[model samples]
Target: MKRLLYIITIAIFTVLIQNSCSKDFLEVESADKLYVDEYYNSESRIFEALVAAYDPLQWFDYAWGQYTHIGLVSDVMADDVYVGGADANDCIYLHRMFNYEALPTSVVSDLWTTFYSGVNRSNIVMQYMDNVQGISDDTKALYLAEAKVLRSFYYTWLWKLWGNIPYYETNLTYPYIADQNTADEVYQGIITTLEDAINNGGLPMKAGSGREGRVSLAMAYMLYAEVVMYQNDDSRLNQALKYMEEIIKSGQYDLVSNFAGLWEESGEWSQESIFEINYFSRNAVRSWSSPTTDGGSVYPKFIGIYNLAGSPDYDGGWGFEPVRADAYALYDDNDQRRDGGILNFAKYAEQTGATYQARYQDQGYFLKKYMARKDGNANHSADADLNYNNNFRVYRYAETLLNAAELIARGASGTGTAQSYLDKVRTRAGLNAISPSVENIIKERRLEFLGEGKRYWDLIRSGYAPTYLIPDGLYRTSTWTTSKKYLPIPQSEIDASAGTLTQNNY
Candidate 1:
């Protein structure tokens, strides 16, 4: 009887254990709980996280690919460049000195989300780096440095767009509200981050064999130099000039012979490129080309017009952003970039059998810089499949040379050598060089970096954005003030903070 009781007890215990195991198996883990802490313990996992951080930087809806919108929405609108008709108001407001209170939802949302997303990702990487093991100290430092530089880049955008922003160093673990930091404070933070990366050997002096998309020490310096120039602080400019000179003397990069090559499909990862947001044609890769299967490229969806004659022009998508006459007139007749970079609306209209006359009722031409060819389509009929591999050029060798020249000219010596820098850019564009003057340098910068999103900041730094009115009837330039230099803090951010954080003046 005792033996029989022992057998029954064993069976009962086995049944309970099996039942508990089954219950545990059925429980689901929450996705939100999965974070940097859970995955960044190994070198391979850390590398994977690093790649994920880069993903946001390459998205078209973000800064890397949405160059046209960012630039036009800020200040440099092309008279003929139109898509979705969103930029019409943007150009008008930007040129005519419209109030920040009047900005469209698209502009407000895109700028807000892109910058925050980039900052959040960078913060995650930085937060987890200390926990990662099995990676070499050099490799670990490089990854950390890259994150810092990228963070600074994103902050620079915030500082430029919304002058006062609540700075977040790492991901918040508890509910918190912070007020906007002053513009100078934000810039100083960026300077300190880049300088630290440079001193710690965190950035690559030159591109490694497989590290085409990564930022080098020289790129960090170039970005720092740009920030200093924008601030117009003499001491900062001198420091910026010193770094620029170092990059120029390094001999790691050069100007590509053909200017168009900088934007071509094949020209990506070129020697002249200091740092670029990498986009690939692979279906699994989240690139501009993989829109439906992944996310679509903004260049095709936003910039590409329906081809009228060739096999791919069926969709009657309206081009929205157009170039201004003033901008068009700035380019010389022989400027190779003028024809290659700016697209004429009438030509596109003639090809598509659409009404071209009223295309730019106010300004006259649309942008051609990022138009897709018929042969480059991935889906052939769908506008989403335009897979041209045009990498966004963030830092280039030519800009470095120009930075160095500008620094020397602006120094206390006041050597009046600004014209030489302006001439170098002009001579490259197949135009005659100009005399060294601040006006010439400003003009050169406008022409050189047109459509690359530098013009608005250039205007701000030169103290001309507030006063520079567009000739078109769309804008009156007098209304813009120093307050207009920074975008108002988004209402959503303020709402989230529930009045704890101060909002910028609208």
Candidate 2:
């Protein structure tokens, strides 16, 4: 019998069955017979349930390129990295995003749904672990550790996107309601979860071959470090620094020689990656907003050239998100990453058969990071259905180094050590070295983590808010001090919570 756990509410119970020789052994059980106690009694059932916990990570828009879009567009609109085009309704929101006026329903929906779904899945796995039998105690501990780490991940996203959210632990099976928790409460919960995972030695220091995609001790430490950095709690800085130092001293990870190789399809499980989201080409599904019936590919759709013979029809809907003239100008001509990271809009148009008509005449560039395709789809077909199975790199060794440098710069009593950390990243980018000044460290972060969905959080952690540009492009101003830093809780979630949860003040 397949034991199933009902997770809709908070109550937890079990069901039993009786069999007789005269009766059919295959007699079906009542649907209501399914309960948590009955299901969690075996190891295999628990393991399968844990596997289901990982599903929410791949939600379209919220996870992949769309995740990058929210941060990049917001940053680019504020600075000179990119500009809005005629058809760039989304970019318009980006430009004015800091203003409470421009918050879009799509952004709100994506943020809320992605993180809550992640939280719910993690809760389910944690709720029923004791019932899993036959597994060694150590193995069960390890699985629990992974669940805690994953829960921290979801909380991290929630902390960054919503600032304050309702914190729920234990599986809620009855659709009970709860009020919102403060930002500090949310941060503490994330820290607690990560610390428990780390102290328990639940995650392996190094990933085993069969556990390639699983979170490890190194990842847990790194995530803890990130949370501490964001919280900006002075007392936690040393702890954050300690976590980073441990990862570095462990010697399990290294920086890849070539930055481009980091994203190359061939580099999926490279040593430099501490943690990354796995996306297989064979199982690729189109993002929810994609217009095509056939699920589209994320990479080719975002980075492929505009028009090339035998190339897939990328809706050419909007031209590639070009490198902003300002961001482009920030780099020296010799910087390899400038060209390596960005694809010129004009160059892309010539390579792909798709036309590169600018939606907004003034804002003309599209992104070029993941543009290459194994093969182009047929015309008018789903061009996004290309064989680009690039895994999204979430945590990398390079980031660990950067995190250390940032911590050291923020008043860590280090003697000339911070500069070396910052230099390593600059050296990799083929740029001149920078001193340990806070501004320089921030600039290095901005340059190194471009288009990776780190900028918005970086700004918030650094106590900087999104600066808005007027429609006429006359002046740039910062409006992030308002409630804009934390996105509003989704209207749908608010409705679901009824009067139990209060909406964030916009």
Candidate 3:
């Protein structure tokens, strides 16, 4: 009864649903593709369109056979992880990316495709909403709000990494060209879309009950704060801080006591979660032939131990991201995150007699957060690796608290003092409370958000990239420079755009 909604499914459904949802509001009757004009005449159809806007975020390059999580590339590009796989051919691009050596030809094109697919679908929904029937003004407002927020979320990724991307509010036609917008322009566009969504006043402070997977007002706020901070927009610092405070004051979210528990199967959508891209495997149908179909994530399989026989603790995997020993040593022994967040495969193998082949650049460590587990991909035919049930927790309460504390430390006014906000997260993680100085918050975020893919950006925005990202001989031979901020635009996109898409000056 699990249905995975997706972008490629769009060709099969004009509005978006083809057993695409399991139940409740997301459930819709499957049909052959219809024209855009023929669909969206009812409230139900319009809802389908809105859901389509969210579907692309779930896609992770199953079709293309690459780890294309928005966070995946960012994490690989960071300094802490080694691109561990069978060899370079299996993960060369990732190794190159981490080394700041990825060419435009070798770019992870799916990152570009997935988010833009979302952007286009979101725009299509709003365009069709104008003519949709059988929905009240209130419902119309709500759907529009959702569409705009989703659109902004998608664009935020493009703006941050790609920079100077083809930006648009409406789906393009004919030549299918969009204006090449600078990062600054994209920022303006995202802010405008988010502001409009907020003014629509149709979203809830938090998603609850049946709306577990949908975006909420607070999620938008978190994203708004994320965008503002990364951009270092001085004017919006106070506004972003206010949004973080609103989530904190709402009492809808709090840190779960167990830091290690955050990665468990039970932790998928816990109290700490603000937003997550959901994946399901109980009835997974997606396979190599139909990569576009609904199924669980292939990400866990990619990061799992390569060439290892199955053990009581975990299944054998391709082993793509071996944690560096230096990064692993950052956690104090008393910190639950060390024991819980990361797994020392060497230590575990010694203690439990579990065996695994050491992957390339093996540091004897693995990210326990998203590793494959026994029964993790159950119900998928034979190919369980492509259907892990790990949902991507995009935003969490801990991040919200930390965001607030960081802002307060930077002198933004807030509901609570910066120290109190910082302490809540630190104390929860079995550490003594410390001053919320910018330096401490920075280190705290490094430990707290590691491998979740905030580190590279954190280093960049905090002006730590130039200094901290020195040319390490192994993975980072090329020191990070200002020009390397944006990834090179995929050459395929440039070819498709003909003259519209220009390559980034990487």
Query: Highest TM-score: which candidate?
Result: 3
For candidate 2, write residues 376-427 as lDDT tens digits: 3323232344324445667888888888888888876533378788787888
Off by over 4 Å in 3: 1-35
TM-score comparison, 1 vs 2, better candidate: 2
Worst ten-residue run, lDDT, model 1? 1-10
CA lDDT of each prediction against the hidden true structure: 0.60, 0.63, 0.82
Best by lDDT: 3
List where candidate 1 sits over 4 angstroms from the true fold.
1-38, 60-69, 76-107, 284-296, 310-317, 345-364, 377-388, 412-420, 474-479
TM-score of 2: 0.81
Query: Compared with the true structure, what per-residue lDDT tens digits does model 3 show for residues 1-506?
Result: 22234433343345553453546456544466576687677887877788778877767545556678766678877777877887766767777788787888787877788888889889978998878877899999989999899999989888888989988998899888777988999999999889889878489998766577787999999989988898898888899999999999999999999987788778877889898887778777767776656678888888888777637877778888888888889988888878687888778877778888887888889988888878888877535667888787789899999999999998888678889899998888889988889889989998998778888889988988888777776656778889989989988888888787778989
TM-score of 1: 0.80
Residue 252, model 2, lDDT: 84
Q: Which residue window of length 10 is worst by lDDT in model 3? A: 1-10
How well is each residue in 158-204 modelled by candidate 1, as lDDT tens digits? 88777778777876655766656888888888888888887885676
